[model samples]
Target chain A: MTDFKNLDISTAKECLLKKEFSSLELTEFFIDRIKKSNLNCFITNTFENAIEMAKESDKKISRNREIRDLEGIPIGMKDLFCTKGVRTTAGSKILENFVPFYESTVSNNLISDGAVILGKTNMDEFAMGSANTTSFFGNVINPLKSSEENTKDLVPGGSSGGSASSVAANLCMAATGSDTGGSIRQPASFCGLVGLKPTYGRCSRFGMIAFASSLDQAGPITKTVKDAALMLQSMSSYDEKDSTSSRKPIPQYLDFLNFDIRGKKIGLPTEYKVEGLNSDIVKVWDDTINLFKKNGAEIVNISLPHTSFALPTYYIIAPAEASANLARYDGVKYGFRENSDDLEDMYELTRAKGFGDEVKRRLMIGTYVLSAGYYDAYYLKALKVRQLISDDFKSAFEKCDVILTPTTPNVAFPIGEKQNDPIEMYLNDVLTVPASLAGLPAISVTAGKNSNNLPIGMQVIGRPFDEISILAAGKLIEEYRSFL
Target chain B: MSIDNKTVRKVSKLAKIRINEQEEKKLIEELNNILGWVDELKKVDTEKIEPMLSVFNESMVMRRDEVFSETSDELVLKNAPESKSGFFVVPKVVE
Candidate 1:
């Protein structure tokens, strides 16, 4: 039996190249684990498709043909991305049986690069909630159990909960994730994985089920920073299908991993140190600063004063866009339909029955903000605050190469703990939302473990399109902390 | 910023989503709570700030005016809940 737990993407690629293990064997190993796993990480599994793809990869290797970057690597796709002929639920009951006829650009890119599709991992319905509990498929249980109380179950932080959980548990070598506010980073923080939300427009959103169009970005949630870079390289490309896709040349991100950050200016935003941050997390942050300082990096204090408004602004903008985007899921089109006597009744019934509580709540909030009477008071005002938040990062980046902060206020909380209170749940993304609002590239890497043995993650925020700098900085943290 | 049941009903109607009496009451409370928190945005001074429509300042990309490949009707209606000969079947909106 292969030790799948210890294998990372880079090492797995080398072993496959050396003929030590065929891609089919690797695929079957992961597929068997997925079938027996108790964690509800996947919403839909494509084991048959995975086996076929792996077989093809083995044939290519046998023929001595050049292999692609992600060739034969088993990876999880967040259920949000539309996979042609496979069920793409987006963790919503509305899309429970929705099978896309076409593939999302990111998934298509992965397939073209020879990556095998392991399965579609679960997520917050329509990527709305901070915790994965809102998923119609059921909440993804964090594999990191509490050391203090074994009976207490931890939630894999969400809305990218399943992606982070799968990577943390070694269910897959890596997985893809989407971040609107803090979907990728927060979950990565909770699960002790490296999750990167690249600069907006870096990856095409052509077939990603829309959440907040402007804020939504596809990124990688992986076991290591190097794997993230490798996956991201294949996932990113300019697409005409998505109008917002950037035409900027995608850099070979793996090449940037070797560069030293001896004199890199690291910023510490004081505003991020909110009132209720756990003291243990603070200790971890301080320890990370010392590690960077030892590496000859300069730490500078900075202020993103408008940070307080990011959460409020995100709530307004994300839902507003969601309200418009999700309007397409009426009974006449794809997805769940509730039969009714009238057209209007059918529309109402289908949406009501199809959406979950969080999705409905967001839809209503979005509708209210964009309504005739409150547009200026709520939605328009949010757009202005959005500008201020983006400008704050713009100025801060002038003095720093990368900004360092704790990814979440604390480690993973027990499932159902914060599910009822939306306000309490929104606070989980307080440190992460600013970067999303600014459309900057940011990554969350495991810093250390807390007293309960739950992993703590620190975020490294970089300038737009400057993912290399943050990746380099993240690698430093990973290396230094592994030795500790 | 207080949301009442009437407002919830009105918003649900606008959103084309049905809510029962119980759900409406719950929604009213949840909406009010969320709106009250979001009302803090009104406190920020934005006298001269332009509303940011997108993070990227780039204009909409223009493609050459040309016909793309046509999608088959079967593929187009593959996921539709109700479909007829090359068209979706919906409740009659026309009188």
Candidate 2:
């Protein structure tokens, strides 16, 4: 029996170095698991390609060659990333056969470090939905072990649901996930793992399929916080190819893993203590606070009064940007084009056949908000509210090193539950959207399991370029909890 | 906060997506709910706040307007479903 529960990168690295197991053996372990489970976690598996890469890694290790960092390690790339010569579907039929000639900067960084590609995980089409049900392929179920027999079970929160599910189920060591709103953190919260969304511009967006360009940033989803740190350290680098990539110096994340957080001040946003917060969620938050207090950390209550408007503002600004970015796929560019009689017919028919229902809804909302007369009323108003929210964080950071809140208002709901109600689906992101709108660094760390055994996460949010502080604070929480 | 059927139809057309009457009704309900939720934002006083269009603090850096410094092979055109000789093909507009 191959057991790979919550494996860390350093453990796998030690195994490779000691010759206890080969890269091929490790790859086979995951590939076989994928074959047996048939969990809708992945959209495409490059098994033959993965094996070839593994063999090459083995040859290097045998030659006493200085193995590249992350050598022989396999990672699942989200389908939103553009992989050269591999199908780069963004969980939509529109780009089903679209093969990117160029590799995304994040993937390129992974390849340069000798990380082997395992497969492209599934997601909500264009990273649009909070739940995985909007996927063109099918819903990706939560991989949590359940005692109930007849219950359909919970959703593996999305739009990066596939990434979280695969890592939680040990289908892959670590996976890449894009967080436009709550894509990475929500899934991580639902599936019981650590997920990080770095400050905007910390990671390059060169070849990532754009959702909301201003807000979309890619980061790591993994079991251990240390592995997530290592992965983010590798993936975050200054690239001239991406204009938005930060020119700031990269810090050694692993070096700070053992640093103590004694006397570090943490804040709890008063606005987050709202009316409908699940009692279990509030209990987790309170428990997390006690743990932090016990670790010699100072806790304060800060006000981010702009929290209420964040969800509405995010919905407006994100879709408005998506409408413009997605206009490139007009049936004439590189994507699936349907048969039509005239030029107009070609565009209309192709788009009508290509996008799913949720995508269309967003596009319409986007167009309406950004249109001539409504721009001032909707788009501009949302932008103003967005600024107030960012300012709210800036003010809070002045008084505290980090802010704490619940990752989501409640636990994961069952599949086919929120499909009929789009508003409820959007509301799942309420607690998460504020951090995203401000482009702050936030992480979701598994606090504990609830009465129903579902995982709940406590979010740690920090100022821009202060990701190290957030990680340090999260480590303090994890240490207090002591290896769950 | 009420999004009428006519408004939903117009927005769908503007968005370049084809929708049936059933979808239009569904969209109206959904949009109305969204608008009702968003109306809460009006209560907040954003009187003095400047709108943040982009997160990057940098504003409008100028670039050199140099012409045709170099060009790569137009390999992107090859992936298109329909293309002519070295150019994208579309139905004749001035026939």
Candidate 3:
């Protein structure tokens, strides 16, 4: 068997250009693996489409044409991204047969860069749960298993669990993931992959199935830090279609990896070392910083005073936005519809059957929080706390160039471990949510493995539009054996 | 604030999703636990901080008022589960 496991974008591009192997060969290698994969990481497989795409890519390569950024690469498209004429479910039964006429801006960019789409990866329905368990399709189990712990089946952390698993398990070259609240980073951490959630407004959310409009941003889940930089360079853009997307120039994120990290100040937010955090993660995090210090980087202690409030604030704000976004799925214009004589009955029954439990729970919470009388106490107050949390990141940035913390509180646990309790499941986002609430760029760099053999990740957060510095810092961790 | 059965029923109606007795029972316990956990937000004294209405707080972009799309009705009604001519045919709003 060829070592396609470590075949990253940079290497694959070289081999293609050097005629070591054709894009068709590489695409077939992955398509074969995906067919054999029992991870349940994909909702809609596009193998036939992929074969056509790979053929088209070979023409471009043989003509010695101006090679595009992601020329001939086979990548996973998270089901959240709408690929025109392809089944885009967003991991919900409602949109099971939903074939979009238009493509999402981010996915369109990747295709334009000459990438072949292998499949639409599964996710938590409407990107709601921290575990992949909530998908209407089925639970996406983590490819990683710890025999020492004797766990039967572990969950790939979500809502980009499929993307993470597909990439980490080498089912695809890399994948695109959308992060509303650590969807990209958390899953990547669990699967020992590098996931980057670009600063909000970095990528337009024009056709991404919206979970939370304000916080949802598109990014990459890849096998390596450099691969993440390459994918993001193709992903980020400004569009008039998305009002929140930044008009700021999309920097060559690939150039970020070349920058030196010596003498850069990395902030360690004390609040992240909270109660009941995994001892294994804490050890890896401390060792990662010490490695940085040895490499001539300065470590600074910073405080995100409102860090404690981020999760509560996220649960409130995200659900409130989701309630409004999901209102469009009423069985009328598109999606699964339950036909009833009464119009309102149709709406009620369609939604009752269309959405899974996690989604409904969020919708109800959103309805309650934004309902009459409760608005001030729940939704309005959450907004105020959101501002405070944003300010905390701003102040911390002032003290240091970037922030460093553990990507998740703990490593991957069994699939059913936290599913019964919503609060426990939501706790998985605690360390990652603060950065999301503030709309900053954060990457989960996979550090060394634990005693139980699960991967640990260290996150490096940067200033607004400062993806370069954070990528530079993340590259250092990638160099250290701690991350290898 | 903790939600009870009455509130769940009201909110479920507002959300246009039906909640049967079994689901209602599970929702009450789950939602109460979640909301109870979320009550930790009250600990923060948000005194005079303005509610954040936007991320990055950038001013909205203004575009010239012109029809940029000439999308056909066929395209618009392409995905409709039920359609008559160019219009999406939902359950009748008025008898």
TM-score winner among the candidates?
1
**Per-prediction share of native contacts kept:** 0.87, 0.61, 0.91
lDDT of 3 by residue, A1-484 (tens): 4557779999999898887888888999999999999999999999998989888888888998977889889999999999898989999999988989889999999999989999999999999988899899999988899858556888889999999999988999999999999999999999999999999999989899999998999999998889999999999888888889898888888888578778889899999998779998888888898988998989999999899899999999999999999999999989999899999999999999999999999999998899999999999999999999999998898989999999999899887898677888899999999999999999998877789889988899999999998888888888894443
lDDT tens digits, residue span A1-484, model 2: 4565566888988888788788888888888888876569999888888999888888888885969878888889999999888898889999988988888999989877878889999999999998898888888888884445666767889999999989988899999999999999999999988899999988899999999999999999988888888889888988766677787788888865866777888899999986678898999899998888878889999999989899999989999999898888788868988866777677767887899988888888898888877888888899999999999999998899899998998887788887777878998888889999999989998887777778888899988988888888777666665433
Residue A333 in model 2: lDDT: 68
Top of the candidates by lDDT = 1
Model 3 lDDT per residue over B1-95, tens place = 57788988999999999879999999999889888888998888988988997786678868879987736788778777899978999776775
What is candidate 3's CA lDDT for residue A223? 89
In model 1, the Cα lDDT at residue A216 comes to: 98
Comparing 2 and 3 by TM-score, which wins? 3
**Residue A101 of model 2: what lDDT?**
87
DockQ of each: 0.85, 0.62, 0.85
